[model samples]
Target: MTNTHQRPLRILLAKLGMDTHTVGITIIAHALREAGMEVIFTGLKQTPEMVAAAAIQEDVDVVGISTLSAGHTRNLPKLARLLREAGAGDKLLLAGGVIPEEDRPLLEEAGVDRTFTMGSDTRDIVAYLNEWWAQQLAADA
Candidate 1:
């Protein structure tokens, strides 16, 4: 959180499935970078497997999914499973977009570290990442 590691938090963002509405995703990516984190946008129409593989291959600190469709209800858990299968389950799994409040609990149960739904502020998200990262560092220590 204090930039003690020299390298910024590496984040990989992806949109799984055929939905190509990337406006929200791109905004998040830019906001995160502006907040001093390294971001990797994996683009639209990516499969869950590709997202997971890229996350592991890129050695990212977090894997973020941007969803605007109902597919997340099914795809999110699958991505979590794939990450777990690839031994990267412990890494942070973040998602944000137009997800419904009714589905948030399900996402958490499916292994999502956090979900920033509609109306969530970028400042709050940035603060959360700072706090969360600090906690991780302390826990490791």
Candidate 2:
């Protein structure tokens, strides 16, 4: 779906912390790009602050984090707070990886807007973001 913004939605995807995984995020990046959103991949070993800085620099509409290590509990919240401090807190923050179901609520409490476990459908992720963008536009209108 298209919006009145007149530009494709921009998304920044990052592999934060010590997580060496890239396959899942790469696939997601391709899917989001295919859906007509501008996708930026930050590669591996990114700190939360670095990701936040890049997100602001890129003027992205969303910040998607892919984590597979235990550092998520430590990093996601820091990134969330950093975004708010940078005055970019309104950007959608999404996390997807090997996160356990029990920890999903914790991430949400820490400012993550959504959590998708491993094997989540890329189509669902795209649809969710599009729906969210539509809602944001409606709210702005």
Candidate 3:
């Protein structure tokens, strides 16, 4: 169902693997909601399979995974591969939290659409998703 007040963007926000940083994900969820998007938070320590399943079940446009435990290299790629295998690779994949600058290019190469560093504004994430949604719709058309 569409939201009348604003274009609805469904998002599944989760923490991958053993990463326990919930503060950033919580803040992002609040920001997305404030921006008129629907958000589903999957809480901490989520497996790649569970994340992909949630994204499919929820039919979310975006899947945001937070990796503060330095597992982005290992986890993000595996998650992307899993999503692809599940036929949800078209869904946007975004990551944040303690991501080092040097790893950005590698993560992008690994199919992560966007990466946010510490101190980046929440509004930036909201705007990125909105733009991404628009682009996806255009591409589909």
Candidate 4:
């Protein structure tokens, strides 16, 4: 379901690498859509290049990645670098799903604007995007 808004925030959701976790990303995508944001979900097994390309092509405001595999250590940084290299460093880079608490700092350092774990609520995610997008709009003004 798509929502009509003056300027609906656009987010792209991607499932990276061998991480086959679908339920979480699916639920999150639905939540974002329900919150009145436009979302483009890239199906599973996407490489960093693919994710970056999709985001650029879609002209999204945010890129949400979900990775459950241990490959996150390598994948996250590469994804960040690619996005940044493409001049998308200002775009909100969000990550979620099965990431360890210990690695949260590393992920943040690697360019993730926010990280959501298992117990996180859908409202929180929406609220964050709302605030971020609002700030961006203000800045652009």
Candidate 5:
């Protein structure tokens, strides 16, 4: 398990593609930091390759991408594929912002670890990451 007592988990937070909404993601980054995790915020308009590259460069345990353009159905899968091809598939992929409820399963099938809709508390995101990171460490061990 994660030496829950050791170093803070590192996370990369980004706004992928043409989406420019940063309010939600900014709050999430602050929340993760408050929850004792290290967060790297990659500003807006990031391509899948850029997102994957940031994840690799930061060596984060998780990557959270925020999108509000209704492109999750199309964009997320492509991002997942790129991450896999780039050898970053082991990193957790998370999506948030304006995601339709009906699209959750499809996004999951496309390799998104979790999807957060509007109104979700930041604490929930942080808690989920903590739990997820712990589980990942346990699995690696």
Candidate 6:
């Protein structure tokens, strides 16, 4: 995939709320990096505010939150609101880990651009990101 920007696509991956799970997000970080994307892993125990601030300060193209503690309904929307409030409404917002099929609409209504359920292929994630980025570049062009 061709990156319109000189630098690789920048993405911020975070562990939101009280979720202690890191294995999935770690693997994702590695996969994104391997795909030549610049990844900023915010470690664990990040708040919606912190992630939003990092996303804006880092000028990332995407923000991904990983949760396995059932905080998706609460945290994802908060982060989305914060990002929009900070004028980053265009940044792709993604949720991963343990999200139920039923809650998908709530998340979408709250401005989450995508969700990757548990066991989602990292290759598919990479392809999705690349495709999304390409579309954004095309739109701009």
Give each model's whole-structure lDDT: 0.86, 0.89, 0.86, 0.87, 0.84, 0.91
Looking at model 5, report the run of 10 residues with the lowest lDDT sum: 1-10
Q: Give one digit per residue, the lDDT tens place, for model 2 in 7-110.
A: 67899999998898888898999999999999998878999989999999988889999988878888999999999999998899999998988888888998
Candidate 6 off by > 4 Å: 1-6
Clashing residue pairs in candidate 6 are none
* Residue 24 accuracy (lDDT) in model 6: 95
**How well is each residue in 38-114 modelled by candidate 6, as lDDT tens digits?**
99988788999999999989889899999899999998999999999999998999999999999999999999999
Residue-level lDDT of model 1, residues 1-141, one tens digit each, is 233354577889899999787888888888889999989989789999999999999888889898888789999999999999999998899988888989989999999989998678888988888787777677655
15-105 per-residue lDDT for model 5 (tens digits): 8789898888888888888899898988888888888888888888788889898978988888888888988888889999999899999
**Candidate 1 residue pairs in clash (backbone atoms < 3 Å):** none
How many clashing pairs per prediction, in order? 0, 0, 0, 0, 0, 0
Error of 6 at 92 (Å): 0.1
Q: For candidate 6, what is the TM-score?
A: 0.94
Question: Where does candidate 1 stray beyond 4 Å?
Answer: 1-6
TM-score of each: 0.92, 0.93, 0.91, 0.93, 0.91, 0.94
Instruction: Please identify which of the two predictions, 2 or 4, would achieve the higher lDDT against the true structure.
Output: 2
Q: Which stretches of candidate 3 lie over 4 Å from their true place?
A: 1-7
Taking every candidate in turn, the Cα RMSD to the unseen true structure, in Å, is 2.5, 2.5, 2.8, 3.6, 2.2, 2.4
Which stretch of 10 consecutive residues in model 4 shows the poorest summed lDDT? Answer: 1-10
C-alpha positional error of residue 83 in candidate 3 after TM-score superposition, expressed in Å: 0.5
Q: Which of the numbered candidates is closest to the native, going by highest lDDT?
A: 6
lDDT of 3 by residue, 35-94 (tens): 998999886778988899999998888899988889889889989999889888888899
Pairs with steric clashes in candidate 3: none
